[model samples]
Target: MPRPRTAPSRRRRIAVDHGAPLVVAKRLALVGAGTSLRPADPNRAYYPLGVALERGFVTDEQHQAGIAYTRAFAVGLRRPLALGIASDQAEVSDERRAELTIAWRLYSAALAAMSRRIKDDTDNLVLYERWPLWLLPGHVEHEADQRHRKRVKLGLDVLIAVEPKIGLAIRETRERRGA
Candidate 1:
């Protein structure tokens, strides 16, 4: 018989950097392949965020706040904020699309809100198509295999890709002195 897969239990996880429960220190960055909208399937979106947090890459609090910030950026927690981003992107002929975009943002905000309250695989986040549209897979199985490879290759591809964006983090890790 196979054991049922489940997320880890909630607890005050210690963060190596600040000496605070990882559940407390605050910050996060969303890598969306330059995507601007909130993802439809947040579980997919939250995976990377979860991994980074679990492995002590980022403090949990920061992850929470960061996700909230992204959510707010997407849907605008304040009416003025929502309106400002909306107006900035709105055009005379694209009013309908603009409204849809706002709706998308709101949906994203709700997802982030829910996601932040938990600690688990679902709570941590990410969202990337197995392959870009330009490189569509020959079949769904092939796509799954590719995504798995990407997950395994994350250290080489995504981590390295993030080095420039997260240079400070990369540097700090190296300074820790590992075997």
Candidate 2:
């Protein structure tokens, strides 16, 4: 009888200057390139407001608040799309319209707070607003990128101060959805 093979471990111990967790075992960056196996990049992030969360730069409350802030922006800025051959504007429910109004208020307030708190660095506010659209696979080298991390934390802190309920609301919603 042949012996059963065990699954390989996801993490491999390796010498690294910064404390970054290794999540992936192997993946090809390009289709036809041959390269040595490398751990997942700590700097790269995909999901909305995930980079700071994954990097351990923000607390759970802060992260949840940040997520809510971003989501509010999305809801507030949403527009009815006219699909192919259908030039009619989709009607939104009264409740949904109210929700959009609330989202706009929340987004405006949070953004104002962040901008006010970091008035010295206007670029920080710009970075926070455009964070969701950042290019992927961007390297977040240590030391050099510490300022950016600090700015993120600051922005989240401002949101937390402005609306502590955002995080609580998100947590409750997630619980209801079993997420």
Candidate 3:
């Protein structure tokens, strides 16, 4: 007889070392409020971006740029009006609307540029949405993951270009760090 399958657990166990400067294998620095708030043990929680940053796949500047893009994207997208709310009452100022339009347009241009730079469909997805480029276990050594890392760097270049201020700030940070 066929055995019934059980649902997989949403939480997974991960080893974390609180003392390490880097998050390689053993690090407890990535836990966020969302992860810690869950019923499951807090140590099991991990933040994908923090892992990515720690792994050196994406720079701090790139991370900030990605966050900015996400915020702009959210602002660009139109939200559904609450039931019984009048459209006139929910409208934003002209300047705010213009800012939103520009933000989305910038995101669109960056997307197109990144699409050109990253040819692989999966790589593009990783650049656009999927994250934590470094996964646990032996996957990091695979050729595919290496390629993903390269693509992520390229895509981040495009994102950084879209937000020049972030690049400038990054350069300043590097100078301060003597890097």
Candidate 4:
């Protein structure tokens, strides 16, 4: 006689539960639609909508201030590079620099296709678009990813794909439940 192997199923209950990581690699903040729609937050003036993980609202932008519409055109520009750039001691090899230059030109051209949606400034709300400096062309392959980033920066895709959603959601719950 042999024993049968059983595994937990719809009818079975398990004592242990799998949960989100103890410490996420990065913290996340929910943005747009729900809470942002209710009231204008003054904190919005500090960081660009679609850039770094740091927090701050950004009602205004400037190149000098290090926050603004800079990244918004990331989809439009050529993919800059580190490998072949000219240097004082040893200027980048002509062949490599030329190659990178052509590559950059082609990259800029490629942006034309996705530029309409990816490069639009108005599309920014909760986060700035993943424009320049933040993204490079050749380094990033695939059209799908570009669009996905665009959606994320707009905060229109994941609905605040972070932990803060709990607080906002709870507040909304209390408001709805009136308790």
Clashes of each: 13, 0, 2, 13
The Cα error of candidate 4 at residue 70, in Å, is 13
Q: Which ranges of candidate 3 are over 4 A from the true structure?
A: 1-47, 78-94, 114-133, 137-140, 165-179
Q: What does candidate 2's lDDT look like per residue over 1-109, in tens digits? A: 9967766664556766552333322111211122255333433343324444444445668767655554444443553211111122245544444454465476456
At residue 109, give the lDDT of candidate 2.
63
What C-alpha lDDT does candidate 3 achieve relative to the native structure?
0.50
* Model 3: per-residue Cα lDDT at residue 113: 61
**Could you give candidate 3's per-residue lDDT for residues 1-179 as a string of tens digits?**
99767567644557575754454324433332223333222333243443455444566787666555544444445432221122433466554444555665665566676675453432333323444334443354768877766776676567667666444544564576566
TM for every model, in the order presented, reads: 0.21, 0.44, 0.49, 0.24
Give residue 133's lDDT in candidate 3 (0 to 100): 35
lDDT of 4 by residue, 67-159 (tens): 211221221133222212112213444443343344333322333344545324323432233343223313444677555555434432222
Compare the candidates by TM-score and give the number of the best one. Answer: 3
Task: Locate the minimum summed-lDDT window of 10 residues in model 4.
Answer: 63-72
- Residue 179's C-alpha lDDT in candidate 1? 31
Please report, in order, the local distance difference test score of every candidate based on alpha carbons: 0.36, 0.46, 0.50, 0.33
Q: Arrange candidates by lDDT, highest first: which order?
A: 3, 2, 1, 4
**Which parts of model 2 are misplaced by more than 4 Å?**
1-45, 79-92, 114-144, 164-179
Candidate 1 — which residues are off by over 4 angstroms?
A: 1-45, 77-179
Which ranking of candidates, highest TM-score first? 3, 2, 4, 1
Say which candidate scores most in lDDT. 3
Span of ten consecutive residues with least summed lDDT in model 2 = 25-34
Number of clashes found in candidate 1: 13
